[model samples]
Target: MFFFGTFRHSLDDKSRCTLPNCFRDDLGKVVYATKGLDNCLNIYPEETFKVLCEKNAKLNELDSAQRRYQRMFFQTSFKYEVDKSGRITLSKNHLQIAGINKDIVIVGNNDHIEIWDKDIFEKIDALQNEEFESNAQLIAQTYKE
Candidate 1:
């Protein structure tokens, strides 16, 4: 599934955040959350996560880099089911790892969703915006359709 949009939300005292209606509808009851590349949290639908696992499984386990990656990725990943109120409670460790407190920014990243602390996201977004055109051009050149 392709997701597109940026949403702002707040985590309640109980650490529950409401999922965007669009995302909730697309993701159904279950989803996976994991430590992401840029100090954010990545959310994936069950099927998408399964696909990712299948791809990762193909990597050579004998390689040190691959083993290290697997350890980090799997160790930090969690599975969550959306509640009746359309909310998900992030684990304390997950929140701490992502440096998230109250306010958050949820961004759609093609096939998945990314959750970011508002301030951190703003800084990263600024840099991303500055390089967007050049990066887009480079990407286009690298992968011609």
Candidate 2:
């Protein structure tokens, strides 16, 4: 499953955005949204989201610290079914969590798509580059010669 699309749009006051038709056409009729790191949203096809939830749910919950992390991610998950108009109503709280009051980007991420606040996305990307630069050798080492 390969996801490919880029959407730039404004979030309406009701916490809705027009998702790119290209992204929805092939991802099935039902979709979902979930919390993502660095203040962004993770969109998943229904089946994909189910698989993810199952996997996450099965992990041992013995450690309180880790459970907290799990709850943070899992509790924020939301299931959404995109409409024919290619629009989705993101939850108000979800929008706030992602700091996406307006202007946003929906980017393909292979198995999923990410919804991000434009400025925040750029900042995170720049920081990612810096970290990736420092770990280039270590990352390269992980690959077989």
Candidate 3:
């Protein structure tokens, strides 16, 4: 499923946050949350996470770099079920890693969702806007047939 949008949300005192309604159906009941690039947390559907794990498993386990990558990727991951109220409780570790407190921004990154601290997300968003025109032009030029 392709996720596309930027939504603002707040974590309750218990660290529970509601999933955006647009993503709720595609996310199903459970999702895997893990460390993401850019210091955000990634939320992936169960099947998608399994596919990712399978791909990672194909890498040579004998290689030290690969092993370390695998360890970091899997060890920090957690599976969460979206409650009846469409909420998920983020782990304390995950929150701290992403520097998330009460305010958050959930962004759709094509195949997965990214959870970012609101302030951090704003900075990233500003940078994206600054580069958007050039990026779009590059994409258009590269894809032109």
Candidate 4:
């Protein structure tokens, strides 16, 4: 399912955070998570995760950049189960890599979810908007229609 919306959340003392109810409803008990771009964590549902794996597998293995990405992608990825309370544990490595503290912002990014440090997300969001118009134009030009 397509995901959209921004949610504010917090991690408990156990390093577990509750996903939004809407997301929990769509995502089953288990999910795939990994380090994502811009210092955020990406959570993918089973089907989407499979699709991502398939796409990654198809990448040219001989290419150094693609090979490195494959290594990092697999290395940082993990399977997490959503508990009955709808919470999932965030690993220490991921938390450190993303610079996340207790407070966080969860963004529904189309096919997946992104978990970010609240302050970091805010700063990046502001910076991104500063060039939104130019970026939008550049993106729009990519459309063939």
Candidate 5:
């Protein structure tokens, strides 16, 4: 399922966060969390995570860069189960890696969800508008039928 929206959420004292209601069901009971390229955290549904793993598995093991990427990607990844209340507890390492504390901005990233530190997200978002047009043009050309 495609995720498409932004939501503001807060982690409780115990580091548990409630997933956005719109994204809850689609995320399934079990989900996977990993460090994103931009320092945010990426959450994917079980099936999606499996598909991602398969894709990563096909990367050239002989290439140093590819092997290093695989190591980094898998090393920081963790599995989480959505609680009955639709919440998932993030690990301390994950939080530190993303620079997240209490407040977070949850962003829908088409195939998955991203959790970002509130201030960091705002700073990144502010820059996005300026680059969107150029980026869109590039992407459109790549997808042109």
Candidate 6:
């Protein structure tokens, strides 16, 4: 499925955002909230998350850095389900990890999606736009279809 949309959602006290109905069409019973690259929550379906875990597990677990990786990123991940109403009550710690505040951006990212703080996403998007504009030719060359 091609996941595509951008929306602003207000997070309630319980950290629930009414997930868009369209977004939940192909979703499963379980979902995961994990730390993302941009201090946002990366929401992954169970199947997708399992693939990631399997790939990570295959790495050298005996390596000290890998052990630390397991402790930090892996252990800290919070798993929750999309309730019948499509509301997910995020954990306080998970909110802190993603730096999420009142307003959030629910963005569809194809294989997965992300919940980003609105202001943060705006700031990052602007910078990315500028950089992309300046290096459009190089980007085109690097990402040719």
TM-score of each: 0.95, 0.85, 0.93, 0.95, 0.95, 0.87
**Per-residue lDDT tens digits of candidate 1, residues 23-45?**
88888799999899889999999
Reference-based lDDT, residue 35, model 4? 88
**CA lDDT, candidate 3, residue 70:** 89
Model 2 gets an lDDT of: 0.82
Clashing pairs in 6: none
Mind giving the per-residue lDDT tens digits that candidate 3 earns over 82-117? 999999999999998899989999999988999999
Model 1 compared with the native: what TM-score?
Answer: 0.95
- Compose the digit string of candidate 5's lDDT tens values, residues 7-93: 998999999989999999899999999999677999999999999999998999899999989988899899999999999999999
Q: Single out the weakest 10-residue window by summed lDDT for candidate 4.
A: 136-145
Query: Which residue pairs show collisions in model 2?
Result: none
4 or 6, greater by TM-score: 4
What TM-score does model 3 achieve against the real structure? 0.93
| TM-score of model 5 (CA atoms) | 0.95
Evaluated against the true structure, the overall lDDT of model 6 is 0.82
**Tens digits of per-residue lDDT for model 4, 3-97:** 88999999999999899999997888999998899999999998899999999888887999999999888899989999999999999988998
Scored by CA lDDT, what does every candidate get? 0.92, 0.82, 0.93, 0.93, 0.94, 0.82
Model 6 quality (TM-score): 0.87
> Clashes per prediction?
0, 0, 0, 0, 0, 0
Instruction: Say what the RMSD of model 2 is.
Output: 2.1
Model 6 residue runs over 4 Å out of place are 62-67
Q: Go through the candidates in order and give the C-alpha RMSD of each one to the true structure.
A: 1.1, 2.1, 1.4, 1.1, 1.1, 2.0
Q: Which stretches of candidate 3 lie over 4 Å from their true place?
A: none
